[model samples]
Target: MFIDGRGHITLANRMCDDIFQADTSEWLEHLYYDCIHDHNFVLFIQYVFLTETHAHEQLYFDDGWSVKHYEAYGTPVTNSKSQLHGVVVVLHDITGVKRLEEIRKDFVANVSHELKTPVTSLKGFAETLLNESMENQDVQRQFLEIIWKESDRLQDLVGDLLELSRIETHNFQLNLQPIDLSKIGAETERLLRKKADDKSLQFNVSSEGNKEMIGDAARIKQILLNLLTNAIAYTGEGGEVELNIYEEAEFIVCRVSDTGIGIEKQDLPRVFERFYRVDKARSRDLGGTGLGLAIVKHLLEAHEGTIEAKSKPNVGTMFTICFPKEWSGW
Candidate 1:
C-alpha cells in the first residue's frame, strides 16, 4: 500500500515484504511499482488511482531469480471527511490449486475415455446379436457371449468406481480386527496361484517378522489381492512374483514384486490414478477395469496406511503397502 497522491508506501503486509524480499523501512518511501518487475502492475496502479475505485487483478513478475503469480485485490481507503486515502492490497497464492484443477480435469477425461470404449463395444455387440436370427445359433451365440463379457466388464468397472468413491469419502467403514499379515499374504498368494499358473509364473510369499496388525481384515485381503493380481497380470511365463511381509518401524510392510513388464519412470507417479493405463489397448484386452490401483490407494488411505511403487523399465515393479500398527485395535 502507498500514500494516495504521493505514491509513497504507508504500510505493507508481511507477504508483500517477503515477495520483494526487503524490510518495510527500506521500501516504505518507494512507489508501489518501484519494487514490481512487471510494467503492467505500474499501469494497473495508475488506472486504480485514476478511477479511485477498488480493483482486483492477477500479476506475473520475476525477480531475475524466480517467477510467481499473485492474485492482487486493492480496495480504496477513505476518511470521515470522504477524502481518498491509500489503497489496501491483498495477495493470495493460487498456483498449486490451479495445477490440481488441471490434473482433476485430465483425470475426468481419461475416465470418460476408459468407460466409453467398453460401453461402445458392449452396445455394438448387443445390437449385432439382436439384428441376427437365433436359428443361426453359432453367430448369435458368439455375439451374445461378447456382449455378456463386455457387460460383466462394465459391471466390474462400475463397482470399482463406486468403491473408489466410497473409499475417498470415508464411507466405507473398516471392520477392524486382529489380523496376521502373513496369513493374509498367504491366502492372497493361494487365491492368485491359478492366475500365476495360467501364465506359468512362479508365486512366492515370505515374512521376516510377526507380520501381525490390527486392521479391517477384509480390506487388508482386498489390498493384497489387488497387488498380487496386478503382479500376476504383468508377469510373463517362467517369471517370479514375490510377496514380502515384515515390520518396518511402526508399520506392517507388505511388498509385492514381479519380474514383468516394468513401468516407465514417467508413468510411475500416475499409476495410482483412476483409469490410468500404461498401454490402453493392452489393458483393455486384459480386461483391466483400470481402477485396481486407484482402489488399492483408497483402501490404504482408509486403513491409515500408505503405498508406494519402485520400478525400472524392462525389469519389474515393486509395490509396497505400509500399515500403521497402532491402528490395530484387536
Candidate 2:
C-alpha cells in the first residue's frame, strides 16, 4: 500500500488484489482508510501517520474458504524537510508457516493419544502378573500373553511411524527395477492365505496376464500386503476378499475388494490419514497400527501412481490402484 500527499492510495501493489481475491480498481480513487476493511491494520497505519515513525505488526483473517495469515510493515513517507506526507505498508504471507505449526501441534497430540492405550495395557498386565496372579500359573500366562501382544503392537507402531517419516520426506527415493507385479501379487496372496483361512474367509487372486513393469518390488509387495491385511482383518467369518490385476490402455490396475463392514461416507476421505481408524476398538482387536492405508498412499505416490476407494455401509469396500506404464520420478 502507498498513500500520497492527500492520504489517498497512489501506489497499491497487485498484492491488494491477491489478498482479497478481487480487483483493486476502486482502491485507486478512495482514501486509504475507506479502502481497507481491517480496522487493526488501518489503525496501525494511522499510528505511523500520528507518530511519523515506522511500525510492524501481524494480522490474520478468514475469507470463508480458508484462513490467511500476514505480517505487515508500515513506514511513514516524509518530504525533504521531514514533513510526513504518506505511508507505505508491505504484507508478508505467513500462512504456510502457521499451517506447519498447527500440523506439528496436532501430530504431537495424536502420537500421545495413540501410545497411551498400549502403554497402559502393558503396565496393567505386568502389574497383575507380578502382584495379583503370581500364584496362579494359568492367569499369569494370560496376563503375560496380553503384555507380549501389547509390546508387539508398540513395536509395529514405532516401525510404521519411522517408515512414514522417511516416506513423507521430500527427498525420499525408490529403487526402481523391472519387476512383474503378477509375481508380487501371487506371493502376497500366499503369505496372507492363512490369515484369511483363520476366519473362513474366501481369498482369491487373479492376474489378467503376466506383465513386467518398472517399480520397487518390495514396496509393491508392501502395498499389497497392507491392503490385503486390512481387508482380511476387517472382514467377518465367511466373508470374501478378492484381488485382481490387469491392464487397461497404458495403466496396470490392481483392485482389492472385501465383503466386510464398510467405512462410513464421512470417513472415506480421511481413511488414508495417519492414525485414522474407522472402528478404533475393532482395529485394535485386529492388531492394526492405523498407519497401513497412510503407508499405502505414500508408497503409491513414490511410484507415480494413484489410489482411490469406494464403499457402502455393511456392503464392503474396494481399493483401486493405477500405475502409469512409464514414469519419470520427479
Expressed as tens digits, the lDDT of each residue in 1-330 for candidate 2 is 888768788877787898867677778857888888878878888888888888998888678898899988989888899987788888999999999999899888888888998999999888777676377788788888989999999999998899999998988889888889899999999999999999999999999964678899999999999999989988899999999999988899999999999899999999999889988888889998689999999999889899999998889999999999876444
List per-prediction Cα lDDT, in the order shown: 0.80, 0.89
Superposed on all Cα atoms, the candidates' RMSDs to the truth, in angstroms, are 3.9, 2.9
Residue 4 CA displacement from its true place in model 2, Å: 5.9
Clashes of each: 1, 0
lDDT of 1 by residue, 1-330 (tens): 554567777777777667666675666777767765568777777777778798999886677887667787777677898677776667787667766878889878877876897789988887766776668788778877888888888888878877777776734687887888888877887788888988888888899987777788778888889888888888778898999999977888999999998999999999897788898788778789668998898878778889999998779999998888787542
Q: Relative to the unseen true structure, what is the C-alpha lDDT of residue 142 in candidate 2, on a scale of 0 to 100? A: 87
Error of 2 at 150 (Å): 1.7
Best of the candidates, TM-score:
2
Residues forming the 10-long window of minimal summed lDDT in candidate 2: 127-136
Model 2 ranges off by over 4 Å: 3-10, 18-35, 47-54, 63-66, 78-85, 128-133, 327-330
* Deviation in Å, model 1, residue 156 alpha carbon: 3.1
